[model samples]
Target: MEHRHLGHSGLMISEVTYGNWLTHGELVDGDRATACVRAALDAGITTFDTADVYAQGAAEELLGTALAGERRSALVIASKVCLPTGSGPNDRGLSRKHIVESCEASLRRLRTDYLDLYQAHRFDETTPLEETLIAFDDLVRQGKVLYLGVSEWTAPQIDAALTLVKDLGLRSRIVSNQPQYNMLWRVIEPEIVPLCLREGIGQLAFQPLAQGVLSGKYRPGQEPPAGSRATAGGRAPTFIGRVLGTPLLERVQDLVPLAADHGMSAAQLAIAWVLAQPGVSSVVAGATRPEQVTENAAAAGRPLDEAARKKVDEVLGDLVDRDPAKTAQMMAVKPAWRTA
Candidate 1:
């Protein structure tokens, strides 16, 4: 793996970072999780991304235990907050109380005193932007957080937060913004990418494989393979299935031969595509097994040639569905929880 600076921050992160979204608590045991983490480290992936809400925080605890020894300092660790952990009204959002307490809890789970990067999982409409900005600044002042970031925030929301940070004279800076980006999802390109490029904020793209859809695993006519994430009843979630179903699978089939021509798996090709884009500092990909981590890490240096890039753009451009009705449906059911 190769290292890149995260936005304007002095911290350097691996181009391919490990993510514990499905395997930590749901699919793999602690031992397996340790093996995967070890595989990532051996492959030179120095950054790991997790969140408090992933499997109710079991993922973070598992990762902390896996990296407990001499390997700890050899990596950069990041975790997110703001998603609901319980049914209580106070259990979620980016309120000052939730933000402060969530950081403490995440630190405990990760067995660390400070985080390399702490991100607000989503925008909190209820809380005043100033209040949230001040709270984040306080974390930096207390030496508990080295940097702050936002996930899934629109351009205006990010602008407002930056303006608030300046108005309050806070020492903190928004160094990065994490968003979902892939061949199947180019929604961020129209505005978010341009904004980040202009503002000097780095982008850490998540779900670069479109939740494994671009991996060429799910065919249009066949049911999802047994033991695969999409088939794991509650694991795949309702919305994900609806979004990446038959129509998307058909689109993925068109890209398989292109991937084969490059001697890459569809997953690696998708990851490489995201890495090739401008302003992309790093890409966060989840792994279920040790080999999966190793495979994703290989995409770090596999730059796509112009012909391959053009082929991808032409194929995806023709298939992308930007229908108003589809967009409206997605916006309507989007989880209220913050994501990055």
Candidate 2:
């Protein structure tokens, strides 16, 4: 329920944000999605994060329907652009054309005049950074966007964008950065976290439960439970399945007892761990049902004492300190490079 300043911006977001990544159109129907949004609002989650490509834009339409007639000023709505929406060459990326068109489309879908936070979903190396920044600045000047942010950007890319903002005296500032952070994926700590802290860019962490791995829903040597995301054949790709299988499940099993020792569910403990990190403005978690909203919000206030925090660090420390070399090599050959 606690609120935190969204970077250097005047906007303040709830410590726990409701994100519509996998659960919006994939797991929850229109009615269930509406109930989940209501649950999040009741639990004091004022920020709702989604993307243009999530469930191919069905998520935004569903959220728009859910928030109809509600007090718009009471909430912070964030959505991202980039990622291909079609087969056309200009269908995606941070080009000025796509950014502008996508923003208008998102506004129409969300039924909102302006977005509280408009983020670039990924770095578009092909698009000139100056062009992208100027486009975002134009959005701010036009009153269509309150602030600008980026998701899944490397530290250098963020620095470059900020530099461009300063050089051009752009109206928009890069106030927040969204990245995947969880017990299973602590890769951001080594460089991205420190850079955000130094630059005053708020960190909005997504996938805090590692796609439900940290929730202990998937056990080793057993099929994913019915109705679970992993159980759905087409939901997760082959590589994700391999990553979430036995080796990671073993780690989750080890951490579950640690979570219980602290009187919390694995989901809560995992989210608390992300919030404990420096520069984290909010942690975005998705929920299929109303009760999951309550559980996720509870992590905001659960005081992870020094002892518990250190214990989690000890358990996950080695896994967190990974060499980027292997990752780079994989990116070179992986067909799923776009997903990363």
Candidate 3:
């Protein structure tokens, strides 16, 4: 796998990272998860991304077990904070108490002493930005976290935090932002990408296939493939529903042949498209099977040339979701404020 520097930081990550956001303990069993992780390592993937809130923390434990006994220095294990991990009022958000405590908890769950990168999963509007950044800075200074990042944060939110870090003279600066980016989702290109390029924050794009929609497995009018994410029996991620429209599916079909012309599958073409974007350091792909991991890892060093990228845009014409407001919209309503 090809590795690239994360933002301006000296740390380098594999271009195709293995992320267990929806799979792992939630969708797949322990043996299957371990096999998938093995596939990633065999494919030379050195980075693994997981969040504290995923599968109620079971994902981390599973990843920890799967990665046991490897040379830790050869891996970049990343996890996030600022999500509700419990029912207690203090169990959520980016407050200092939560940030510090969550780091400790994550360290234990991941079976590691220090995180390669710790990120604020979302902008905590309720907590003072200074408190959050300072707390993350504390983790770096204490040697518990090596670098810092954010996910789904808008350009303005990221800018505010970076400014606070400079003014406060924190030890660590935000090096990356994790966002839903794909051929079908170009929201970050307009605002976040420009600001991050200026600020030296690289993007670790998740959902690079638009939650599997861009893989061309979902036909325009056919039922979603059995056991696919869309047909998985549970509360599916809303993004999957958003892009399953017939128009979008038809557009995705147009890219299938384009992928063939490049000697790649539809999914690899989708991942290569994200990597072709400016300031994107890596693409976080999740899988339920070993071959899926190998298939995605193949996209690492295979970059789509200018003409192929243009063909993608031409085929996906006007169907992309480029609204820069969606990032803010994601954080607008705090889940803590909701009643089930």
Estimated TM-score for each candidate: 0.92, 0.92, 0.95
Tell me which residue pairs clash in candidate 2.
none
The per-model lDDT (C-alpha) reads: 0.82, 0.83, 0.89
Error of 2 at 143 (Å): 0.7
Q: Give the alpha carbon lDDT tens digit for every residue of 34-137 in model 1.
A: 99999998999999999999889899999999988845567789999888988889789999999999899999999998888999888888988888888899
Task: Give the candidates in order of lDDT, highest first.
Answer: 3, 2, 1
Q: Which pairs clash inside model 3?
A: none
- Evaluated with lDDT, which candidate comes out highest? 3
Query: Runs in model 1 with CA error above 4 Å?
Result: 237-239, 321-340
Candidate 1 local distance difference test against the native: 0.82
lDDT of 2 by residue, 1-340 (tens): 9999987678899999999887787778689999999999999999999999988888999999998888999989999999887778888999999999999999999999999999999889899999999999999999999988999888888889988889998877899999877765655677777788888899999888877778888898898888776765435434245356565676677888988988889999999888887888999999888998999999997767788877776665545533322221322332211122
Task: Score candidate 2 by lDDT.
Answer: 0.83
- Give each prediction's root-mean-square deviation over alpha carbons: 3.7, 3.2, 3.7
Superposition TM-score, candidate 3 onto the true structure: 0.95
Q: Score residue 40 of candidate 2 by CA lDDT.
A: 96
What's model 3's overall lDDT? Answer: 0.89
Ranking of candidates on TM-score, top first: 3, 2, 1
